[model samples]
Target: MGGNLSAQDEPASKRVAAALRGRIEKGELAAGSKLPSEREIASEYEIARTTASAAIRLLEQEGLVLRQHGRGNFVRETSPLIRLGGDRYSRKYRGGPTPFRRECERAGLTPRVEVLAAEQARPPIEIAQRLGVDSFTESVLQRSNLYFADDEPVQVVNTYIPWAVAEGTPLVERKQTGKDGIYGRLEDCGHIMTTIREEVTARMPDHREREMLALPGGTPVLQVIHTSIDQNQSPFEVTRFVLRADRNGLLYQLAVD
Candidate 1:
């Protein structure tokens, strides 16, 4: 066929890439199968050899294919494992602006948190259970915040701590002067949170999150339910965080029993 392209007149490289992508997606080019040479593809598609090479390179970069030095390229047999909702997710930096700041930095994204409500308040039902307290317990301080990235509100988090542990710390005492990181501040008070449990799920954003995050209808939000325990194995904090679905990629690692 002639190079009539499309109304948008996409470049030859993209066109070739698209054609090859279609075949791979449709399973015509099965995973692990070697692709035809660039010269063969160019001849078949009536395009320049450079365009065919570009297509293969694009696929390699996208992790869809592997190019062996002497053996041309083969479709990737397996995709990269994107872990999600795992326990004890480790990061390079221990205490920082946020537990996830290091990961965001690695991905070339800026992460920030806006302290919304850091005052003392009764813990909600969800927070009580994880904190190992009675549902009606009013002896707690609630910390609610809106987390952002690159000016986008990505997560809304609500954390709770029993008053005894929070009363003497800046985490709850000086709500006006927001602490850098709640966990860090807790550690400063000689209560190091050595264990954390997190439960993650994806669901459509609720009205409050939709309005605050300016999320459009049908956009899903990842909900992370977490519980932090101090060195003595006592529950210290309970947190519920809602993260924008499109803004994050969760990693999970599992070990077979």
Candidate 2:
């Protein structure tokens, strides 16, 4: 079947994709529901079969549909929403469940963490500068972590700590930090946290990140650089968190001065 496209200036593929996307977002196409076949879509939309295929590809890139080699296209399941805010750093939450775990629990989702690495490593120039260490210093501890919500990878975190601060503590181990996270352990070491500084940016994920997070093409990620400061006004930790843009919402509660 064919139809005239003179009325709409947009490309045929885009129009078809838009229509299908709306259906998916409106829940007309439930998660895991199969999409119309290329032939069916082409006949229904009165577009070329190739154009219908391209439309499905577009939805795949947008992470709204998954196309298996033999199983045909299907609507993708939604991910849990994570809210990142200042309250996660409160002392009350520290040394209990990890902030990530707590957030997932609050959302009624299972939270899982895989400790990728925890070892002493040379810090990057930016991290070294933030920690007030010389460029040549080899005394930094790095902790790399992967967080999953409901078994879906959602975020990657890399935290750097000055060797002087983490040398004699569990921070140097690759084991769980118990109820208290790194911040709690630091508190036990006489470094009381006072403030946190965060810088947020967004960009498309690099190849490595895309593979690690199993992200779809055209999906962007949120990069958050966090600096933890102690009561002495000294920066004790620098953490880089890469969050799946589709799965997280950041909230900042600012005081009106």
Candidate 3:
């Protein structure tokens, strides 16, 4: 407890929270170790019991600690790390297991996909633009999926395909895309993808995203918008991927020809 105290201008709860967070980080309080009880913290820190409780609450909100019913708070477990690399999109990889399934297998975790919605709907203006369709004149097949690694939600994906291409395909069906995934199906439909473009950005999660991803307070999410184009220079699919910042690392490899 003899570490640097918070700035004088900081609130009492913040000061207490900082000290505990330092301890946790420094391994003074290891994972699964119980934190001081509110009464004990109040007595030791010479602060009101409510202030001590607030400090603990702050830690809980940060995902650094978890409170058990009738029991005190304990340090929470760290999440598994996942690397999303460019090689995952290779035709060879697609011919075998989906990238997500392969990654989870490598990490010894179960991978599961829950189809939230699969239907034909008018695309959002941005999606329509990416798909080379007029929002007013065309409808797109939209498929939303929630991906889990060992029961922990890690990503949300929304895929949009022009109705002309997906109207009679499995992309509009509420089921797994099988071993080859959507790209393989697209190829089967005579739309062989020759290029893919992805735009990535980061921001704080919205309320629904926070709940769906079970993110800690102050955690940021990564958004990736992907467009697949066929050899004919026509866009075939547009997908929006929402990933947990703390759990995934995105990697892109460029061949040095």
Give the winner by TM-score: 1 or 2: 2
Candidate 1 residue-wise lDDT, 62-161, digit = tens: 6577778798888766422122445333434454434556555655667776778767676777777778766675778888888676667877888888
lDDT, candidate 2, residue 170?
A: 87
Which residues of candidate 3, in runs, are more than 4 Å off?
Answer: 1-6, 61-63, 67-71, 255-257
For candidate 3, give the lDDT.
Answer: 0.86
Sorted on TM-score, best first, the list reads 2, 3, 1
Taking the tens digit of each residue's C-alpha lDDT, what string does model 2 give over 67-161? 87798988877655666577878887754787888889888889999999999888999889899976686779999999999998999899998
> What overall lDDT goes with each candidate model?
0.73, 0.87, 0.86
- What's each prediction's TM-score? 0.61, 0.90, 0.86
How many clashing residue pairs appear in each of the predictions shown? 5, 2, 0
The alpha-carbon deviation from the true structure for residue 59 of candidate 3, after best TM-score superposition, in angstroms, is 3.0
Backbone clashes (count) for model 3: 0
The lDDT, on a scale of 0 to 1, for candidate 1 is: 0.73
